[model samples]
Target: MEPEAKWNGSSDQVEFSRMSPRSQGFTKLPGQKTCGKSVLLFTFVLLISAALWGTLLFLFITRYQEIVQDLGKLRESCVYHNDSGILTVIGQLQETQLNLKTNVPQLSKTLNKLQEDQTTLKSKASQFSQQLNRFEEDGTAFRSQVLNEKNTATQAREKLQEEIQKLWIEFQRANGSICTKCPENWQVFQKKCYFFGKEPKTWAQAKYACINLQGRLVSIKSREEQVFLNRNANKKGSWIGLRDLDIEGIFLWMDGSSLNYTNWGRGEPNNQGQGEDCVAMRGTSGLWNDANCRGQQDSWICEKLATC
Candidate 1:
């Protein structure tokens, strides 16, 4: 059957009635057009998404290459600084080793010199000790020799004293055996004899007369002899043996003996007139006076040993 077609008042739409089966299958439906439009819009959106992803990937690759180059430069700078510091430390160690080598020999020489000085001091000390020992031995020997000499001198002196004592004893025994006596006109006292002359004579004449009688002028030895002579003087001035004929004021006995005792009167024997050289005993006072040897004449006394 044939279908009827009607035109509507719209410009793009048409209405159709029932048609044959073959024509109906070939004609486009309104719902099929709408489905095609939707598929086109979905394809356009997918293409835009793919283009934006491609641009982002290209920017990331370029920035990654630049970062890798900067890291490489920094690592090279650090390696260069480490090499310079190592070389400086090695140079300082070499300088220290050279200085140690230069100083070692001088230190060794100073040590050796000190050892030599110590040895020399030890030698000098040993020599001093030996010399001191020798001096001590010599002192001991000298003291022993002096002791021996003193003992020898003492023994000789003792023997000489014994001999002198024996001789004195023998002399006394010989003198005692003799019967000693004084002359007829002489007086005896203490183993000595004295004679008083009454005739006044010069000192020289009196001295000669006494010598002729085998006697010397009286040399009074003690107070006892002087007293005895004084009594027998007969109250007259008598010449004694004392005189200063050799040197003025130095009285000596006629027998050449030293004058040990004196009985000088007041201001007497004063070298009177520088001419009185002979001594006389005053009969009244028993004191002695100096008189002129040749100008004055006086009575004299004589002395002699007894006949033994």
Candidate 2:
């Protein structure tokens, strides 16, 4: 039979009596079972979602801690590397400074020495320039003096020549001949007189002797005069009016005339012993020889214009 269902107001429940088997099966409804299954499934899904979120949160915290630690280590390493690099740079800079300190003084001293040497060179150059200037000035003055002396010598020689010509004319007019007679012991040739001395005297002595006799040492001009003097020389070495008293190796006559003719022997005027400065005629060949002026003694010849 089917159970009758009644509502009990005091219990607020539904009562089943004399229930059939079909009604007993009706206690568990299909909609209530489906609703319970749906609630259990939703609870299980919520638990699984919570567990997954906790796990993900733990992993994230752990990774964050590891990253913080790695950052700290990197900071420390960078600080240490920077400190080491700074120390190395500081050491190098210090070494460079020390080298500069060591070398600066020496470099300064070298520069100073160079400056001093340059100054000394400039001073020496200035002194040399001054000396050269003085030498040039002195040379100009010497040239002027020499020119004046040469002009004076030329004028004196011309005046003396005019006086000699006048005297010669007067003598010729007085004697009624082309030439006056010469003094005794004097040989006459071509309007001139010559005297040969026998005494052996120094060149200075012979020169003075001729001057005392109002004549001069013989100056042989032409070939004829030379031959005449040679013939009368008596084959004896005699002093002539040729000498290099002023300058060596430059013979000039006593009257300041340059040599127009020379009759020098072989290797003559060698200035033997650096002392021979006078000229003499050789007795054998009539060729000239250089002799010592003050040290040698030789016979001499004198010459003068013929007089009335």
The residue-level lDDT of candidate 2 at 231 comes to 88
- How well is each residue in 1-308 modelled by candidate 1, as lDDT tens digits? 56777788887987876667887799899999999999998888888888888778777877787778877887788779978988888888888778778877987788788888888888988898888888888878888677757645653553455345445545765777442468989988776688888888989889888979877788888898888888888587988888877678778786555778878899886776758999888888889988888854457898776654
lDDT digits (tens) for residues 70-98 of candidate 2: 99999999999999999999999999999
**Which pairs of residues collide in candidate 2?**
none
| Backbone clash count, each prediction separately | 0, 0
Runs of candidate 1 exceeding 4 Å displacement: 1-175, 178-180
Best candidate (score: TM-score): 2
lDDT of 2 at 149: 93
lDDT (0 to 1) per candidate? 0.79, 0.86
